[model samples]
Target: MSPGASPWVLASPDVREETAMHDHRRIGRELDLFDTDPLIGAGLPYWLPDGGAVRHALEEYIRTAERRAGYRHVYSPVLGKRELYEISGHWSHYSDDMFPPMDVGGEQVVLRPSLCPHHALIYRSRSHSYRELPLRMAELGGMYRSELSGVLGGLTRVRAIQLNDAHIFCTLDQVTDEAHAALEMIGRAYEALGIAPSRHRLSLPGPGGKYVAAPGMWERATALLTDVLDRSGLPYEAAEGEAAFYGPKIDIQVADGAGRESTLSTVQIDFHQPEQFDLHYIGADGVKHRPVMVHRSIIGSVERAVAHLIEAHGGAFPAWLAPVQVAVLPVSDAESEHAEAFARRCREQDLRAEVAEAERGSLGARIRQARLVPYQAVIGPKEAVDGEVALRLRDGRRPDPLPVGEALARIGVLVSSHSTALWDDGDGA
Candidate 1:
């Protein structure tokens, strides 16, 4: 195993290969992705082995994509000083959803309900130049919410959330383009995860004391986000009072197997936070000017994303993200040696593969157990002698026998490309 890798990496914890369409709660239990304990309270669930692997893969993927897109990653504490939220106006405008403040050593702190306040402080850490206008900072960090017990069914509504969050501090002129790019990033991430947006939402301010009182800022922020959606030609609904306490946002919504919808990703134009935090960048004229803070999330939260994946794909994740990508089944104990060797070869290629244990009953039973795996490589006496293997795909396509090397190559292609296609004509299935 790689350094710092989870001990669960070796086991990968096998799950049923095929799943019927069900809500994430059912699939999460059946697939060993996550579970909740009454002692730990509602809205807090712990990830199991298989679930952790999927979440880790997603975090790494988003990290890589963010780096390629010029986002500087950062780490921030889940707990923030009570004064921080007060300064950012969360205490006034959004305290209802926050946990009660804790007094430690005469200092009050609370689990952060959002990352923007902390990120705003980071932006204010030092003087920045106009050339550094669009400083994009990202984090796969934890935030907490005080969700009601009734609303906390599964990962979808959680008290502790691992958010794929970022903030881009850009000049006024850069706001529209940055928001547009952010929306596109969310779209690309959905495509890679085999996810589809149910609809796009322009979440605008409505009648509320929760929203910032600045009407001009609200109008400008709404228009900027509206321009992004309009230019993209993607149809969207303007949801009143759905905007953040600070600004208007573009919410990318996804529906579960049960037809329930939730926001999976978001891009917001925040002029409120910069002014609240007194964030500024020196302009070409050497005068200090406020920088707009653009808030965005690609895959909102790992827990919720996994929940959606469990339902959307029916637990048959894409090869790259699947808990168990390959299951090598030996015809009998006679071919178990070849099965183990093939499994080792797959592991060397960094693919998640496992050899079926002989104690799991007959070869037919083992194959049946592995039906949810994206690819099943079957080894038998004849194939062992011929140095080839039969392939069974999750989509029920069995290609002609091929050398193990060729099979591995094709599997690697699909996994690395993050393609949704199960088979290609080139594979000759």
Candidate 2:
């Protein structure tokens, strides 16, 4: 049987159902988004063309947002020397979660588990004055970890993850304001995606020896975060012992359609790492002082974010983000030229459109297949002669036949505006 015909390919009910909606894993396969192969590795997934399209769209969106927010995006190596993690204290604290190092010419190198240490090195590469404080460096970096085989699921948990990661080097006095700004950016992202604003979680270090910072620094950082939350007018719940070994963080928890909540974004204040890395900037008094490091992930991981979007929207993506926005289906071989021409016009207008040839299937079968697409433009004898297309929305609404130019214009508006509505007709059906 084909991969799509296999029932075992679908995720368990617990993995993706809230009502009768489709499972993300099933939709992923049906839509040709991504797939896993046991021969390569258990947790690794290869993204198909459709999946790659969605990811590209998402990455562009976030990169634009970060640029507007004054972040300087950069690229770094995926693997680093063992001594690099040792300087960042990850070797001592997070060694269990990291992949074992490989020997290379008498040196040990490992895949980076996080982008923090590399970012620290970037900050320390140049001397900075007080005026250059709050340097925001961002990267959509790939990381590898030794995840348990049993815990790996589609996109949510994996051994190899791509992080939407960044670090900010700022003075101590700028902590509260920077945290507040991070929260505001997260709010804007969730709002754009049409996801409900998730509740805030202020995670603090517990009495366990897992925490690495001095007791005094932990208290100050935790108190500063609490103040930031209070001043931002955002309600939050504080949790003890949930903080990372190096810092206290605020986690944004979002729920999927199945009511399963996961941390999708975070802002952390780290006093320990800067001290360990000896990151410094010249103060106004002509003295050197340690810079406070702020770690943040607006959407966390690209893979996980795409998975959440798949489940949250049931794969009916917004017009701007849809892999294939419109399918042009010709009723018969006679209309195939008209259909192809119409598709070409739509593509020229910057719309994602494709022509479904009539040679492979009947009109009815073609329509059934096009149902997976957001919009279908049918060109029959009447439509071909009249220079119009019968627009059939996936939501089952059949609007009146529209002129080819008019239909393309309207779709261009919707795509440019990123409207969530299937149609911009007065009724918004």
Candidate with the greatest TM-score versus the true structure = 1
Error of 2 at 204 (Å): 1.6
Q: For all the candidates, what are their Cα RMSDs to the real structure?
A: 7.9, 5.7
Compute the lDDT of residue 369 as modeled in candidate 1: 87
Q: For each candidate, what TM-score against the reference?
A: 0.93, 0.89
Off by over 4 Å in 1: 1-21, 427-429
Task: Residues 1-429, candidate 2: write the lDDT tens digits.
Answer: 211121234445765555246557777887899999999797798899889988887788788889989999999999999999998888988899999999999999999999999999989999999999889999999999899999788888888898999899999999888888988988887766666645688888777677795889889889988998999898888877779999899988776654556789999999988988899999999999999999988888988888888877778777677788899999999998999899999888877888889887997898888776788999999999999999998889898999999988887877666566778787665
In candidate 2, position 30 carries an lDDT of: 78
TM-score of candidate 2 versus the correct structure, residues matched by position: 0.89
Candidate 2 residue 152 C-alpha distance from true site, Å? 0.9
